[model samples]
Target chain A: MIRDKLCAGTALGRRIADSRDRLYRVALAWCGDEMLADDLVQETIETGILKSRQLKDENRLYSWLYRILKNAWYASLRKNKGHETLDEELLADEAGPFSNCQQLEIVVQVRQAIGRLPAEQRQVISLVDLDGLPYCEVAEALEIPIGTVMSRLHRARKGLLGKMTTAPSGAMTANRILHLVE
Target chain B: MENTEYSLDDQTLGSFVDGMLDAAHSETVIRAMDQDQDVRERVHQLHLVKDLMKVGFGHTKAPSAHSKKTRLATWRLFSPRIAASVAALFVVFAAGMLSQPYVNGQPGFPGEMLAAFSPVLSDSDNVILHISESDPQQFAAALLYAEKFLQEHRSQGYQVDVVAHAGGLDVMRADVSPLKLQMIEMLSRYDNVHFVGCANAIRVLREKGINPPIIAGVSTKDTAFDHIVGRLTSGSWKYIRVDSLVDNPGSA
Candidate 1:
């Protein structure tokens, strides 16, 4: 029994370490802050290490782990007095690496569009697009019904498509058509 | 503007592109694409949105390599974003762009680095000073680096986070830290300078039957990596590994 528990613990640790980047990506997409997202992923991994037994099905581990991150983000939100987002002016003023570079500008536009999304929509989008978790896994991660996952993802994609269509910048439909056709 | 031969709602098209559709529904959409140029065009746009998303959020290693199956693999074969800037990965590192000048006799980022990386530095002037060594020289070097960076910067907004973990936890321990007085003085001197102890490290030490008391000025975090990640991603924070600053530390 002791050996089995130790083996299980070792496996869980490896999985947690492997999932760190994925968790970080989703957290970054969810909260829109690299630093906060990193901390959230670390906390989630730490909790997963300690509470591995709570997880009954290893197949659902990513979703279970993501649920912990979702809760941690919410806890962090509460700690900050329920400020879900930074002030738009404040966010606009913040500059990232290579902000002056042209390609970086397209990335900036994409991020700005995501920043404008409602938090729930943002969560599903990040899980789907960034983390590459399917609709079912995303639903499992956020503890929502699969239907909610699909709907939010649909709305999120619609929002992104709206941004692209309006801007006519970045790699949008027009740009693709411009490149695809003679 | 109407194609009577085949049609798909935006939601259905979005699902089909995302591989959320069942095999039968996906095949229907594929047939629609074969007959209608507009269907192909609209599907390409839906895919463009997802590709842009991956590029935007794929900051960590192998940005889009985590998943076992990617329905978008076909689109990647002809992705324009890849052609435009295959080298434009997220978060370009040019800390080397700065002169590794000496600050109070320790190698550190000079003030001129601020102007050199304006948008990245100007947005947030934060530094993380990480030390996990028990060597006295490395410890003193960290102290000097911290005090000098904070003292020399003209902007009061400049902030420093001292993260000590593993063997380096000794630097933040109340009974063990060699420069406890200096740490206390530094803490009192600058409001922006903060010291954090790793709770994970502390707990490990406790399990080993030695619970070293952490200094009063130092706060405890769940893990050092969490604190470090928070600092880096929260803003334009630079990381300084104490060991990298020196080749050999003099024994205590």
Candidate 2:
């Protein structure tokens, strides 16, 4: 039967393998934490599988998965009583915190800066800048028009520039300084 | 370390960095950099800043290694019936004509009839457009049509969102054209009309030092144009060409 043929072609295995990284990165960006991102990615994958039948075109597996991720992010955010402030301590420099640790510090600051962005801007930057998806692809995943993607990316970059330009020089620590240089 | 000063705006510089400039323009920037210490320093600073940001943000850990355990656990949770349902449809095509075909005016194929008669159908109201052309007039006209359509339909409880992607984003830029400026202003009045530009475009633009305002629209989804086309073909939502809307309002 045609149905049996369709069943055999269930692309769940391939879809999971291809989207694992993208889903993880999206989750990480949304939650701004590693463990949560992992959990979200897992949840997204499971949901993607359950809803695979709804995905009429298997070629669009990644976009379909991303839609599920976006939905999950929103649902989680809503249930959590909207936005939460980023923990400054995670970003603050510690005494003599690993000299030549500029990379770690810069990473922290960047993450903090990203956290400061509006949810939509953050999502856009994460998918395009961090994940390195093409603009068209990012548009598909976000389910927005490409123009919106460009706008959000612009805002996010501008926000980053503002944050970095204004951040105190000494407050960055030597490690953070080296991180920027290297 | 001298600060860079030059007449070129950030967007122009950004375009230069993005390699979007033609030879003559690039020659001009290169000559300016040679003659102006401040401009040179500024360009250097911009490069440094971009590198720093890329380093800070680009280091994402691989997801597959971390998610393997959780995926297995979740896979175990599927009930046999549910799993069968998920796995069964694929098998239906292999088995010949398991369900009776019903006549709906035209003889309905099994799948088509089932889709039509399905009790759990949900309405797809989302409309996403891809505007890749760069003509500001066409872009503005599209926005005008979208505004009119949304205005007419919102009270009828319809949700319409207009998003411009790629070259179409020029219309949303503050400096593009007077017509575009008015389009952006008027389009913003409707809470439902979302204007978005592509991030890749922004990155390319920003690298050249252009600072365009971020439009309040959804970020671009890859291959989303195809998705929109698919939806239009399926009668999910009416997809109107901007020109068609202007020329043939009744059909659009």
Candidate 3:
């Protein structure tokens, strides 16, 4: 008899569900497309369910899920590399075309700036800066070294600062800092 | 007392913002920031960038609640009702075994085994397409629809499993299916595409002294619908009824 208990109402399922938004956010930042990000998150959950048994440590649940999502993202990247682009249209509108609010504009700029970063830098930055994962955990999730994470994080931050601050001479430093959002 | 080892570089500043620095390094960074305007400015920039990134990308909406329930039900397949129902069915089968009048030494074949061994491939990312029509034209249209759907979704890691039974079994038979070459080609190209035939129907054909020729890559199960239902009850698979699409097999 097949054991149906593995995928059933286990603690792992609940934990995976709880981290859905976090996965989506990282996916959105990584791919810069809403629909593609949604697909990545859903695929990650399905894969996680099928292979949850391979996860040996329960304490590493979130990082384990992140690793799954990251691998899925890379697989997708490889799959679509030859014939198509990954969300170029999503990066086209960096000025918040859908909204007129000034506050949302900065968020759009930040998104655009982050989008322009190299993919490696973008991945590390989203995991660290956006998701607030610790350096070691981010390294573990990405399967990279801690020093690499730090170096990438530094470059990603510098790149974002340059794009946001050097946009034009229209705004002062104080106003920019005031507009900084949490 | 300058800590020459860990300078106030961008890497150190970003780590400081992330709380990723060791206690000693963090203390040194804090003291450096207190004494140096440049360090404070860089630290502020890192904080602003981090916060801005959070505010910008952290707002992606979670998937719909209905989709969440569907995913959970399909992936987990362990609702109390489902488990209880399966248990009750097993108990009923066992009771029937006891009530049956003894014949030869061998226990009569368990009736539940028929449903249990439906030859459904348990691949996680499956899409079941049901076709009950034996018309060559209908089969062609159904295959076309499936091909279109598979082309769009196959890259996204979905398996398109076709279940044919009763009159539909003709669609999987090598002699009868008009699209045999096409089916073979599809099976060759996409491992995720599957065609399953019902054994009960085959046995019925044999009882009538007629032999069935199944196509390559066409698998057989005890009951096609039973297997489909089992998979539907257990996993999040897309089930498509393609007869309606025969006339107007529009884009998938």
Candidate 4:
């Protein structure tokens, strides 16, 4: 009995570890705070493990995990008192593409552009474009219909394009690289 | 430049880029894109947007120190209880199996027990047979059975789609197979038959310098295996292994 429990636990642990990075990225993208993202990710993993038995189809694990992470992000957001004062330097450190920028000006602008995005657009763009999830899978993760996914993605792309084009040349170049991939 | 309004909307363009468009439709879109500068520019911009997004997201690093410790502590507390439950279930299952009587020197389990249980198993009032092989005899038998079945279900509105993929591409190839020609002619009269090929497979074939005639059907978005699995799980389709279908038509 002990051996069986250990085996189940190990299997669950491995799945959580395999999905940790993506879940953390999603959480970070949704919440925009490293500490809160971490907390959300941890809560998601814990909840997923406890409810793993409820998952009937193993093939849907990725979508199921994404759903859990989405729920946790929303729950954490509701519990928090307004937007937390995010440390700009620390956030810049966490931001990709700007991590190596020794020029503080470029990093600040890039971070600001990301921060300026409406929360809904930011989350949709992050999951679909940044994460590269297929439209169907993104719909499953967000608990929205495929049409909603398409509309949100379209809006997010429009918003991001507007921001990137208007930013300074240096930030635009960096953002062009970032936005193109998304 | 001749002004021709492209019918390919954003959804279709996205689907085309994602390789989700059916073959005939994709061919039409590709030809249009080649002829139109605006279409080409839009595609290029979309590609650029995708690349920029990848760079912006950054690499996924390992978990932080605090998270690692919390995970370890949680595991330590929960492991024992889970272990006990698993062991108890295993023991009960083993005991039940052992207590069963033997028949004909084999375990007296019913025939139904032998069939595997799929994770997303379901039942259907009608079955759709997806055929994607080049065997003429097998194809003929499948068609005969499907036709008879359709005749019975015609009033009830039962649907069946016979999708041909990969080597089965020859089954729907315009020029190669006379049997394919006859099958297509017969299927054209039926409202519920669908024949498809894998577009990715055709692309791979083209890259290898093989100009196998394009099948006269839509290409599946994913691999044949994924499509089959999805259909079977959803209970919309059932696999009739060509060999099994032909060899034991009465049984199937």
Candidate 5:
């Protein structure tokens, strides 16, 4: 029994370490504040470790961790009350767009387009399209019906098509395109 | 493979794009796409959207990935001392369990006792009002309704969070909102009230190279309605859509 318990604990630890990067990226996408994203990830990992025993099936670990991360992000939002904690000077030093000009432009355009989607649709798109989770898993994480997930993902993709295609070639940035659309 | 008349619905199409469909249904959709140009184009656009989203968000790894020391610093926040305390408590409880009779197990200590002593705060009332209108008159009407809401429930210790987004950003802008002074006064008067603007809306203006004057007191969220929806799903929050509220005042 002791040996089995040790193996289970190690397996849960490995699962958490494997998911850290994906969880951080999703948190950043959801909140757009780097500091808050870090806080969310840290809290998620800590909570996962503390409550790892409650998790019954090993096969369900992936969706279970995603649910924990989502709940942690929401709780942080409630506690902090919509505070912006992104350090501009720090971001400028690191992650301030790469030298690959065309690739950089495409990235900016896509990010802004995703940002413009309605909040409900954006959540579904973030999980399904960006994070590459299955539709059923996305529904489980958000605690919504599966049909709602499909509809939201459809609307989100349609919105992105308009935003991505309508931008002026070469000369205009995402904000100008967004302003024009508005 | 000759089912051209059987059109695929949005959910089926989306499921196909996400690879959630079974092999048999997936083959049917592919066959239909080959026969219909419209279906093919939509399937392609949906694929493009998914690819674009992946390129946008997937490549941007957290900066903490590069700094092991910084990651350790964050881990330190959880504290080994607290973990040790929890571990010690578990060991002591285990010893007590082994020493006792197996008759009932006595509700297993601490969690049940804590629950018995804890007060019920779940009965408290909360609400969220989302204002998505740019009209100054609408803003005034929404604020008036907020005032009435607080007056009725302030004695009961109710909480309210007001969120503004999209064209709603205008209501929180100092240069644009006609009720800017009134907003400032309301902020000072009500400790329970909060006004939040959408951060993505602000980012759009900044990226356009047009900086507008913004009011000082309002907070900025990643998305306004998403925050409200999160609260609504978790707890019993009476959600008042201020745009709709202004359209039908008697119903609100």
Candidate 6:
């Protein structure tokens, strides 16, 4: 009855479609391969549709979907551990190399850096920062305790700082502008 | 007041930057921020890391319309019960739409002006690849994707049509097409693949005294829209508007 709507129209189906891009972005950062990211996103959407009944609260659908995605990602890694790694990168390049490298340099570097992090750390930082999920929601999504989420986030930030961020010395700027009154 | 002042660790500062700090701890960090330049800088750098993560991933795009691939109906691949359900759902959706005004890019036929038409990941066995942009790289990418699709679904015998209209007409033009040899090769290889040039586009070009010759093995159509609507109404065909190499995750 109520669960039936999740399959049909404006609810779960459309929502799954809407989540594809962000999922691809997260998947890309995780795997660093566009083709694999596409496969991951597709798998996530399918799994989301198949397991819609497991989603008890519509409000928590995103977290549930992400959890499913994380699980699927792990499963894929397990499944492909010893498989022949044909250069899908070569096949992907047949579609033409990215011509806008200059425009995408910083973005590519950040993505590559994220790709370089340990899987657990990458997952936490992406869920927390890239996806803007709260610690609780990220914990729920990753199926980890909140403490683990914080620690992984700290490690991920430390990993990224040396590679991506610059320590520009400047006068301290206020996080918020505070006015002094007489 | 109990001295809420405490030493700040990297994790606490990271939490503070992420707004994960509890009230008392947050206040402590805020108070300390006024006194410690290093903490301020660490917080700023943490913020920069977060912002770069957002930006880098924010602007990251897939090469080509990956969503339009033979969708992961892996669930459908396994369970006939669910495949039946999806099939039945499509039947109902198509039936429901027939009674309404048939807009080209309507809800059931979801596609943006320059995005893939098959957002719902339907059971459609074929697609019409479209291009109206004169960009050479774009044309090559679309052709490459179309051929890859043909190779993958060769057994399924999927029908693919490349329709070029307006500025997209250049892709099918003999002298202009950057991928003329590749297009010709693909045309020979996949009998089910159709490459179309819009006469309406040719007329516009002709009006400017530029009568472009279309490549051999390609066909001419009256207008891209007519061909699109005709194929869509007649069969299970998705229309893909090839504007960029980016995987357009748009529903329409």
lDDT tens digits, residues B52-146, model 3? 77666765465564544454321122111000011232343345442432225432223343232122222344566666667654464455445
Q: Of the candidates numbered 1 and 3, which has the greater DockQ value?
A: 3
What's the distance in Å from true for residue B42, model 1?
A: 2.3
Considering DockQ, where higher is better, how would the candidates rank from best to worst? Answer: 3, 5, 1, 6, 2, 4
TM-score for all models, in order of appearance: 0.51, 0.42, 0.51, 0.48, 0.49, 0.49
TM match of model 2 to true structure? 0.42
Q: What local lDDT score does residue A63 receive in model 2, on the 0 to 100 scale?
A: 68
The single-chain TM-score for chain B of candidate 3 is: 0.49
Encode model 5's per-residue lDDT on A101-172: one tens digit a residue: 234345545655665666567678888888888888888878888878887887777777776776533323
Per-model CA lDDT versus the true structure: 0.63, 0.50, 0.63, 0.52, 0.59, 0.61
Tell how far residue B199 is off in model 5, in angstroms: 34
- Name the DockQ score for candidate 5: 0.14
Which regions of candidate 2 are displaced past 4 Å?
Answer: A1-12, A53-61, A82-100, A173-182, B1-54, B62-252
- Model 6 chain A scores worst on lDDT over the 10 consecutive residues at A173-182
lDDT of 3 at B92: 34
Cα lDDT tens digits for candidate 5, B103-194: 25431123322222221122344656666667654464455545555656677767777777767778888887766765676677788778
Candidate 6, A45-68: lDDT as tens digits: 777887777778888877887888
Candidate 6's error at B93, in angstroms? 66
How far is A129's C-alpha from truth in model 4 (Å)?
A: 1.8
Model 1: how far residue B8 lies from native, Å:
8.1
Give model 2's DockQ, 2 decimals.
Answer: 0.07
Worst 10 residues of 1 chain B by lDDT: B74-83
Give Cα distance to truth, residue A94, candidate 6, Å. Answer: 14
Model 5 score (lDDT): 0.59
Q: For model 4, how does the per-residue alpha-carbon lDDT over A140-169 read when each residue is reduced to its tens digit?
A: 888888777766666655555566568642
Better of 1 and 4 by DockQ: 1
lDDT per residue for candidate 1 within A49-127, as digits (tens), equals 7788899999889889989999999998888754445322112111222212233335545665777788888888888
Tens-place lDDT digits, model 6, residues B1-252: 112242238778978888888999999999988999988987777777777676567654543454436332211100000000112223323444323322453222212211322223224458676676786544744664575567567788888888887778888888877667667767766789899888888998889999999999988877776566446434456544554332332312
* Candidate 4 local lDDT, B1-252, one digit each (tens): 112253226556756665557899799878979999987876665555455454444453435655445432110000000000011222323444323334356433222211211111112334444455666544544444455556556776556655555566565566665345445544666676665555656676789998777545434544544444334323334444433444332331
